[model samples]
Target: MTDQDDLLPIGLEDALPARAAAITRAMRAVLDTMDAHGYDRVRPPLIEFERSLAGRMQGVATRRMVRFTDPESLRTLALRGDMTVQVGRIAATGLAEAPRPLRLCYAGEVALLRADQLDPARQRLQMGAELIGSDAVSAASEAVLLAIASLEAAGLSDISVDFTLPDLVDVLADEALPLAADQRDAVRRELDTKDAGGLAAAGGQAYLPLLYATGPFAEAAAKLKALDAGGELASRIEGLEAIADRIGGRARITLDPTERHGFEYQSWFGFTIYAAGARNAIGRGGTYTIRGSEEAATGFSLYAEPLLEASGNAREAARDTLFLPLGHDTAIADRLRAIGWRTIAAIGESDDPRALGCSHRLEGSEALPV
Candidate 1:
């Protein structure tokens, strides 16, 4: 048998040269815009104590994190799967007394257990930002603008940002239909899948005739208004609409009345960008308030691998250059190194001129006998 003690081959990734170069260049452009807007960069280590990764994220995300035992103290440790949670911990512990509103940015590889139907590799390169302890509309607007600017900088065209106010869904569902917890969850799941028939069944369409109706935002809003949604829920829906109106309707906007359901921590508006007809969303983010701490946060993460695949702007392959020395010229090597050029020393008479650029015809040298 092969040595059992041998380390398992690295499964996650080795970003191919071209892909790595492209990702680096793209990230630089995106991060530059972030820096210009007053968001300072923060580099958090890849590994932290297990409890550090344990705040606010769903159980799924928590379980996927790779864990180990510390050799010195035998404390449980884990590879951080998401930066935002770590950033939150940093804010809670490190920056507790620092400031009211903090703006931070990060670009790093995150490890997530491969979800079903994903490649076996768990490593993912992500670039994202966090705005903590702020609930202003301006902060939300800035987040949207940042998303637009970054995607455009990366050369993606015809991009559309879909803005959804998760609270609007909660308000509407609570007022329009008195759904039991299980029934409400089933309806939201079906709606998330955009399956009209399934959603109808989940909401018990015949008993609640309004459940099946679906369409553009205007139509949905009209339906809600017609239902005579009253009190705080109604006011919250109007408040959300005014926020959307303030966004100038320029962004390709959509309202999924079911938005607030899945991500338990999502507190307010949630938006995601989709490149027309792409299977995966290009990016996703939203404002959320942590449950117990009541700390408000907003941010998003770009799926670098998919974004790179969809992005046509990956840097071109570096030009190949072969260095051939007819005789022996140590001087040529020195010059090439000085000018920052790629070079290879050719030996003997069998070197092919067609395969090389700027080949040298060297003369006598001690290294190669004259």
Candidate 2:
């Protein structure tokens, strides 16, 4: 039986040895891939002033952040639920004068105050790269391609991207479909849930075509084009075409133009990426204007846990290990380690090399299979 004192809270747990190794390997691969692409890595503090944290991003829900009064500043400090906001702040303040289209990547643990029904964990590992100062089609394309590269480096295959227009409602409501002010929010809510009945109830029956304009990219994009009776969506449609062309055959592409579920602040374009074996999206990215600086940026955030799950390995194959018995030559062991051998020294003469996960026994200076 487990003791009450040893019980963990509902949404948190330790990653045992093997799992930790997998997460570490995945993190390294992702960060290295981003670095190779000239995305400088940044490490932001886990907690920041609640106001500063909340002020930098539009969709960041302060209610979902774990907050507490800081004894030193007497101001509220909040654990970050996302690192993209902090990256935005960095680009706006510290690197404000950096050249246009600054690139930054980060990996960190984020905690939420409460878990949602669909996603149970309140804490998760988020990794992302932000391209600051540009939300143009080229920037969007780069973000999408880089996201695929990073996930691929982390050992995921058969990745798919579902694209969205975060501001689809606002754009149509403004002119093309002209919705009443009171009906706008209801329409967005209904569409987010894919509820056709609720959409009509909310006075958005005119926008019903958007519901079916979701599927394979080629088909959905064509449907979306036909639905645009006016030329209001012409530019947006063209931009999507440009991005999809850039993607080529690298990933499976689909379009859900009105998907506003996890996207709170993306502007023209957004995407949720999924691996073949994952149940939910492993990453999401899009274009947005940074809140404080009002500068355009494109970025994506990927979760490590989902990446590991989709990769289907809690740990990788065991590496070749050498066991050193008592009184073994220390210098020889050092040489073996330097040459890529993993050495585990015996504590006693009776210690079994196989039990210690050592594939070879260090007999004298040579490693021989046990």
Candidate 3:
């Protein structure tokens, strides 16, 4: 094959084992924090029935999910676009009998559709937890803690969480503005573009006050409350304030009514995590109570590429080591297997009693002899 042919497919690349290991360590740290909080770990397959995946997501994310058909049965299959939906399915069907308020955590790659600008096709190595069947604000609160602790546990300290809710838009939509549904979406698009003039044109005078009112969280929260935003919107602002207070007000929390774009599925609280120098947000999670279910569920996904990029400087370097024993290769391999290593065969062929293959190479350690 030619060198050109060796290149990876669009929006996908093979991560070196070392890089993948770094991601795994980061994910493990986050998962450990979740596990400590009574969140059980579960592994779902990379692929599922297309109907299952398609019906669960929409927009660019749904389109980005890789799809295929089973060869034997011709059942449509798709690589998951997000882990939360898969967990929701598990809660609805797989674990329906287990219990309510199920706490589940997972770390894996989610395939998302590519955009021409900024975000291209990417396999998001994500670690996240879901609080299913829970209606308490505490469950939502714990999700934030787990997410923050995940970053802290992975050595990412200089991170910010911008917490907001979707209902703010609903509030705007309910106002007696003359703009139509499409116009509202356009105003939203204009706000996203930060075009003040465009926002004024679409929303007219009523929207200008809201635009000018934007500022640091304290000011914004006060304005949101003053708007008489009650129900979900009001409650979310209060929740965020309480969370900020609990976290000592040093967590860099923000209340953004403009955060609702592209996240139609997130019904209640929404948040995005940003590292100090990163141009884009690194992690995002939110809560929503879906229909046919009485309880609210919430969760977040930690993006692996950006997380590793921001976290490289904080991670510790450890020396490597290799261990292999003689002819009882399988026995030694099993013993080491219990120790948790992504074991690979050592170099050279040897049949000696003490020459069987097995090796442990710490991340950056010297290469093992064949």
Best by lDDT: 2
Q: What is the C-alpha lDDT of each candidate?
A: 0.65, 0.93, 0.68
Model 3 worst lDDT run, 10 consecutive residues: 353-362
- lDDT by residue for model 3 (57-99), tens: 4433556567777997799788887777777777777787878
Which runs of model 1 end up more than 4 angstroms from their true locations? 1-11, 118-121, 172-176, 180-184, 194-228, 231-251, 260-262, 276-278, 317-370
Off by more than 4 A, model 3: 57-61, 72-75, 113-116, 175-184, 212-215, 229-233, 291-295, 313-315, 318-370
For TM-score, the strongest prediction is 2
Compared with the true structure, model 3 gives a TM-score of 0.79
Q: Candidate 2, residues 95-147: lDDT per residue as tens digits?
A: 99989889999999999999878888999999999999899999999999999
Q: Which candidate, 1 or 3, would have the higher lDDT against the true structure? A: 3
Q: Supply every candidate's count of residue pairs whose N, Cα or C atoms clash at under 3 angstroms.
A: 0, 0, 5
Considering summed lDDT, which 10 consecutive residues are worst modelled in model 2? 309-318
Candidate 1 shows a clash count of 0
lDDT of 1 by residue, 1-370 (tens): 5685464544565667778778887788778878887777788899988876775554335567788899987988888887777777766677778686788778898886544354564777778877888855666777777776777677665666655655544554654556676776676566566666886788635223334223455566566456543553455456446656665644555555444433455656777776643556777777887534668888777767667765764576554443546554668657656766555667667765445543333344222211
